[model samples]
Target: MSEKKTINDAVSKRYEHGFVSDVAADTFAPGLNEDVIRRLSAVKNEPEFMLNWRLKAYRKWCTMKMKTWASLNIEPIDYQAISYYSAPKTQDGPKSLDEVDPELLRTYDRLGIPLYEQKMLAGVAVDAVFDSVSIATTFKDKLKEAGVIFCSFSEALQEHPELVEKYMGTVIPVGDNFFACLNSAVFTDGSFVYVPRGVKCPMELSTYFRINAANTGQFERTLIIAEPGASVSYLEGCTAPMRDENQLHAAVVELVALPDSNIKYSTVQNWYPGDENGKGGIYNFVTKRAVAHERAKVSWTQIETGSAITWKYPSVTLRGDDSVGEFYSVALTSNCQQADTGTKMIHLGKRTKSTIISKGISAMKGQNNYRGRVKVGPMAEGARNYTQCDSLLLSDTCGAHTFPYVDVANATAKVEHEASTSKIADEQLFYLGQRGIREEEAVSLVVNGFCREVFDQLPMEFAVEAQKLLEISLEDSIG
Candidate 1:
């Protein structure tokens, strides 16, 4: 086949996860108000304190305006037109996988995530969130044996109120940003994890988020805390059904790594980027931050390949001596998609360190930008930071840009930044073609090689999946 024809054929493939699941849902009216928050809190059976907190966040959000970024051109969101809560009508707090609805299980099965423990990946616990509620959590008993607490946010609030109240907004405060504040007021469900002191979680932990309802926004809150000498790794994935009208997904994630502890958080975001003309898709806006104490470590790795418009910056705050933070990411945008994503590192203690590595690939009119910041405080003596950003453009219509911000308040701090932009040159393609390589496969190989550094940081199993996703996202950009 001609190279152009091959590109067109590949790009025409539909998003595999775009089909909607037909399940009855108890949905709220399309509007936002104090009453809606109260109803949401009441439905969840939350305590008085939780209700008060949501009220406070909601009031603040009412007075706040959405912050505008120079690099992002997003349409004005009609908050009153979005349903803030949607849950499976039959959900009654399933005690086990079997108690969950069969249709919900089938939905996950179609998404390649098995809820049944025996049929799922070994040593990996999963929490499946459909719409705005957590449908099921697998391997709870196994996780409990190791003194770990892994369950839905609502469950954590009901079972461990003190812990939930203590660490919920400590990392990302209630009024951190507009979307986060909105989430704080009406978040229906998400995952909560706690690793006890001196205990390392026995297996990998994951959460899969699916937005199956139309005109209903999904707001979920996740909190993870690692006590001293504890360690854990967590993963998150997201998807949404294809629709002609854009949907909203605003989430918040907070990680607290106490002294001598370690935490790793990764995300695989595939939220159904709109069709070639960008008629519809999810508007993904999220806030994620981690606080690392003395001698602690926190790392964030992500593979972002979907969403019509993405605005996110997962960050880390080094708050104790000898603390370390790392951010690794690979973002792919194609077919009218736009992405503005990166990380932030704040060094506040002596001898703190941080590293950032980012890769961006743009094809077929996709626009990708990386904006990051590295800061060293006056007390952060001997602190260090290194940042590297690379962008690859697969077609003449696509564009990539980078913005780096650095602030050094300590003379002893050492910070280095490096960036490069490149295109898939015809000469390089010819070099591979001369060796009998097909144009499509050659493009995939080159793109994968360009992204290997970031992919290597993903878990072994996820790395392979990420490579395949990258290949599929690039199939239409060869022209």
Candidate 2:
């Protein structure tokens, strides 16, 4: 076989988590309005403050238009045609795995979730979300005993409304942007965490989202708070079943680090990408931001390799003197997928520091773009910022683009930026081919080396998974 054919054969694997559950679902009718917002809030039984906030966000979203500043060419979406909420027929949260539906449990097993009581990882707590509602939050008692508050957003609103109301939109305000506004207006379920002062989270906190019901938009909202002198690490993963019709997902995540605290967040997004021809998949638009108080720190690490169209920019704002922020990302798109992903850093306090490292891999006819921004305000004297963006192409037909914006108003501040774009060279492939190395293996070696810098920042569990995903995504494309 030719080298291209050999490479093609390796990359043509199907989406492994694309099997749907047959259980009946309760889904809200497709549409959006003030009434819909009111109904959703009522269903969640949120406090009055939350309802008023949602109304304000909805009103603002009504007057705004879809953001087209991105280099992506997205199809028109009918907001009224998307179901706002969908959940398994169960009317309440699962109190335990025994209370979960058999179908849902089976789905979890198929997706490789560690839900078994006996197999549970001792140090990790997970909040599992199916469709638009959280199904279960594991290790609640353990977390509570340690004075750590971890639960679903719904549970947080009902049990700790004060905390929810105080930190929910503090990092990314209600009127932040177009997608964020939509998420604030109709977000149904997500994860919430609060690390008390002077304590490090006993274990890693995590959330897994699975999209089941067809034609339903998954609008999840996540908020995390680390009080002064506290530290916590959080992980988020997501996947969806295969479908012929495209689905919309707009989510918002906010993080707040009080003085002398640290918060580290990581994501492994494997949302179902449409078929090779881009026939069906999810349009993932998300906004994630964090703020660091005096002498605090925040970090974000992500591995994105799925979704037909993915738009996300995880950002950090250094608002306190000597605070620190860091972002490390690896985004890969294959088989007609489109991804525009990166991060932003805002320096507003004296001596604040930030670092960014991004890697993009494009295969088949996919298009990948790295867009980032760094700003140093007038008062941010002695601030320091560094950025690195790199792109790798597996096919001649693929494209990679970069756009970096740096604004410095203080002469005392210093900023450095660097970018590189390269493709798999024929000579390199030939040398490998001559050395008895197969095409697929050669590609994997080259790609992995290119991504080693970013992968080094990922948690051990996700690093292996990301490498496997990269192999699968590029297997057939280079052929």
Candidate 3:
């Protein structure tokens, strides 16, 4: 117990990336209407079809009510008070890191984001999004040689509208949910990737999102399409400066894997959580989904440690025979943070299979909820699914809940679920302290040991980063 309190003190420091940047920005008035949608479309110089799509989404969003059935306690949001769009006033928009504004480059550099071209040669291609626009993209020429299209969503809209039009809204339609509809209406910019048939991407594709301006809602939409026999891996990371008022973030991500292809997507979300009193932070409501065609596979791995309130469910659909889907996640909530997140797997074709593993950690007055669903359709003969959910509590004031739903329409289908809840006992900490390990090291060791199952599924680089993130997020809970 002594070591546990010491370790909690180490983790309770303020957020690392809480410094706001000062840069000239072009921002829209705090309001939403058809005019705002059209003006945003004009700013992007989108095609007529794109403009029509946004309008349709706006009309639908206006009629639908935000669902609050999840185990999250979020205050009502005032859409009219949020600036729908905010972008840096860059002259002609910099095409590369050198041409980018020095202030913006410094912002990313301070955040430890690699924006320099030399980093591209080390097998990482990055697209950096600041506020509402993409400021720089590295290694475009190298990816072009292999018929891979990796750039900002805006670039995809301009250069490859046909591709975007074909896949956009296919996996999760505009009316699928309330937040998704809102995102489709006002989304500014995000990353887009296309891997051609039979070609494995040469390097890992990544995107880093930074929310700089205050009172601005970030609505970035990401779409990735992998052709038949192609494969790719993608990474997404985000952070926001500290502020006194809660900021709203609604984003959508879609993935499409054709026959015999594979896609692996990973995220490390470190959005700012409010102070101990929960006075300020971000309301992160996001929708992420993927579709797996015949013999294709899609895997989602995420580690979330910030945000005042988070409600998300990354899901997958097995649409063709023998397709596979997977979801692995580790979510930690400390202080007054609240999170209700999990995944859904829908098996539609024959012999489909899916695996889900989730780990939730809560401390102080935080709340963590895991809600998941698995459905095997009538045509999905021989479908199989396995789900495991585990929760760890560091303080008696915190709470953890789990809700798992399973539906099997065919007799040949099989489904299984397991759940466990545990608290950090004094004896465990005492046992570790007797081994001569430092308090922080002991805490990290215990936390890592608990999450080893999900960590093994992450990429080599991402695994290390996630372990460190877990240690940092839990540092202050005990003190």
Candidate 4:
């Protein structure tokens, strides 16, 4: 009905991997043990306090069990069969663009990330994590100028021990969930960001993650803290080369927005999805959340179009009066892919408000589900929430579902939810065909329109690239 939708209808084509490279990998052997964890920590040169923290997490994880409650039917994961760490051996750490590896820069260029270290050296900052280690971090001095701390988690633990000790596992406790516990124990590398009180980050903070080693699992943990009156926007990108064996990728991300502070986190995940038969792909199980302290706000926007099995739910807790939480997501599951993803909003403060918008596209035997919850505590007077979830199935072999749980203890709370499932109409494609657009291009346009609502929330540069990635990834199923 809308002009944007018309354009999206033309862009609903299926996708496939565009660029495959022949880069060599530097890796550790497959396995998990105290020795492995210790080796990883030693490689990072972590402080004693941090090593003890990791050891504690490892002990807790050893006693935990793997989660098996989702509708997915995945094979049992073998921890010992996965390499805990990997990196590219060709590149030594570079302080500037000229000193960086040309091959590495080419890879980012193919992935469509703007990796001009000069621009970053001039203003923007980046933490580029390849496999298990952070290769380089740009614009460190500039961020420090504004009292912002942006560096790898390992570096943060050593340079800012007090800050790391105080905030680590504070938002998402170590025992929060199964995968989270695993991440706490063995996460090899991730970014850490802290914005000082009353200071807005002068430039955007971002991390680009790539999985290069075969049989290696990627477990990265990201923690961000915004002090009172501080503001920051963070972006993350993921990509892995094509492989037959399913690789495990479990990650945890936590954000804490203190009083009067605001944090916006965005992600564009393009992991390698298996072929139509589901033979080889990544199993992406992630837990991400944010807590908005009194009078604070946090927003999460994600575009997911990868993985053979994806199970994720990014949630927010509103503990501050008048604080707000928002989630916008576009998830696509094609071929034999399965995705069970959504969000949760817990209203604990007066006048707290939350919004959720989820769009799912399923094609060729794909299965998609949106499971979410909105809870208004007894003391949350005048709380409000709104949710919208829609699914588009490209063929009869695909399926879509929605499960929403609303718990309202206060009578004054306002809650609303709407869900629908539909398929692209033949007439719509025919209309586009009549206008001289090819069938594939027409399909891409339509699907893009369907996802505009969520894509619009992405940064300007990422939004355009995500749209193109969606179009390329769905190329095979459009017809």
The residue pairs that clash in candidate 3, if any, are: 8-475, 8-476, 11-475, 11-476, 12-476
Residue-level lDDT of model 1, residues 204-317, one tens digit each, is 999999999999999999999999999999999898899999999999999999999999998999998999998899999999999999999999999999899999999999
Sort every candidate by TM-score, greatest first: 3, 1, 2, 4
Q: Summarize candidate 2's per-residue lDDT along 1-479 as a digit string, tens digits.
A: 66555544555567889998997888899999999999999988999999999999999999989889898879899999998988888757677878888888788888888776567666788899999999878888889988999999999999999999888888898888999999999999999999999989988898999999988999999999999999999999899999999999899999999999999999999999999888899999999999999999999998888899999999999999999999998888888899998888999999999999999988878899999999999999999999999998777778899999999999999999999998878788789889998777887777788889877877666678778876744434552
After superposition of all CA atoms, the RMSD between model 1 and the true structure is 1.8
* TM-score of each predicted structure versus truth: 0.97, 0.96, 0.97, 0.92
What are the lDDT figures for the candidates, one per model?
A: 0.91, 0.89, 0.90, 0.83
Per-residue lDDT tens digits of candidate 3, residues 209-304?
999999999999999999999999999999999998999999999999999999999999999998889889999999999999999999999898
Model 1 shows how many backbone clashes? 0
Q: What are the candidates' C-alpha RMSDs? A: 1.8, 1.9, 1.7, 3.6
- Candidate 1 residue pairs in backbone clash: none
Number of clashing pairs per prediction, in order: 0, 5, 5, 28
TM-score of 3: 0.97
